[model samples]
Target: MEANELLRKVRKIDIKTRGLSQNIFAGEYHTAFKGRGMTFSEVREYQYGDDVRDIDWNVTARHNHPYVKVYEEERELTVMLLVDVSRSRLFGAVGEEKREMIAEIAATLAYSAITNNDKIGVIFFSDKIEKFIPPKKGKKHILLIIRELLDFTPENQGTDISVALRYFTDALKKRCTTFLISDFIDTHDFTRQLQIACNRHDVIAIQVYDKRDTSLPDVGLMRMTDLETGASRWINTSSKRTRQAYSKWWYERQQSMSDTFSKCRVDHASIATDEDFAHSLMALFKNRGVR
Candidate 1:
């Protein structure tokens, strides 16, 4: 993309996602992902209802009066976005491509994190770690992330979610709230990696897909290409049996992915290209906040 065009796209996303962060997700995000622990704020005079365990002996002795330690929730946190930038994300027949939707969602989440005074980082992966932008705060950092989301291309074409998850688990020592954004189209088994990552950090999965991915159009014979492998094949889309089999395959794949997430005890949401992702995201946030 041209520099001017890229800048325009970034500005546009910034405007839309910034509004969402301020108006819709800011409160819910803060409620869903809490800080590490409470820290001491100050000491206050002990009241009749105050817990005896909270009494500050030093302060009470110094002032010759009852005092209790006060504490407040630490609200600062580090958020990571593990994004899949594989060739399959470019396949979309019904609406916006998976890549486009992923970018928008990532930008919205980044804005939401900053609104809560949390640092945000990104791991762009495609069978390998394509890029790593360390966590940072402020609008400048978020704008840079949006720019990269819109323009960054991966060096590899295949998808290996396990590699990305393993890297994430090892790279950050402190527990972080991580969002794994992908289509979940990898053929390799990543359940073990996902389980380990979830055990170490708070991981949420967002699966963005196109309508065509679920079922094929009844347009007679069609040629399909595997974006990642550069393989091509012809299929009879008009045949009822063929269509049914394809749908079944897609459904089974989705069910398996859902099962993996459940086993890992991770929060997740799925959104289609033709659907309003805001509603799905809001549901996920509300659910997590309640928990």
Candidate 2:
């Protein structure tokens, strides 16, 4: 993309997602992801009904009266977006490509984080870690991340969720809220690594999908090619039996993924290119409250 085009895309995303973060998601985001812990603000004279444990004996002795320490939630947080840039992310059958949707969703979350005065970062990964942007707080940093998400190309074409998880765990020693965004089409045993990562950091799986990935239409015979492997094959889409078998396989795959997420105790949500992702995200936020 040209320099002008990149700037235009970044500006467009800023306009759309910034308003969303301020108007729709600011409070939800703050409530869903809490601060690290409470920090001592100051000490004041003890009042009725104050917690006895919060009383400061040293200050009470100095003042010859009961004093209580005040504390507030340490609101600063780091949000990491682990995005998959494999070839499969390039597939989409509707309004926007999967990659485009991923970028938009990432931008929305980044904006929300910055609005809450939290640090935001990103890790673009395929089979390997393509790029890592360190966490920082500011609109300029957020825009840089948005620009890279829109333009960065991966060096590899395969997906390896395990590698990304391991890298994230190693690099970020402190706990952070990480969003793993991907189509998750690769066959890899990431359960162990994902479980470990979740133990150390708060992780959420955002699975992006297309309608065609789950079902096929009876549009007669069609040629299909695997995006990750560049393999081509012909399928008789007109045959009812073929469509049924394909649909069954797709459903089973989805079920297996869901089971894995359940076993790992990770929160998972699915968004399709043709659906309203904002509504789905809001539902997910509300559901998290129940937990």
- Each prediction's whole-model lDDT (CA): 0.94, 0.92
At residue 142, give the lDDT of candidate 1.
Answer: 98
The residue-by-residue lDDT of candidate 1 on 86-133, one tens digit each, is 999998788889998999999999999999999999999999999999
TM value for model 1: 0.98
lDDT of 1 at 105: 97
Tens digits of per-residue lDDT, candidate 2, 1-291, equal 899999999999889989888899898888888899999999999999999999999999999999999999999999999999999999988768998899889999999999999999999999899999999999889889999999998889999999999999999999999999999997888989999999999999999999889998899989999998899999999999999999999999899889989998888899998887888777777788666
Give the TM-score of each candidate.
0.98, 0.97
lDDT of prediction 1: 0.94
How far is 137's C-alpha from truth in model 1 (Å)?
A: 0.8
Deviation (Å) of 159 in candidate 2:
0.9
Using TM-score as the measure, the top candidate is: 1
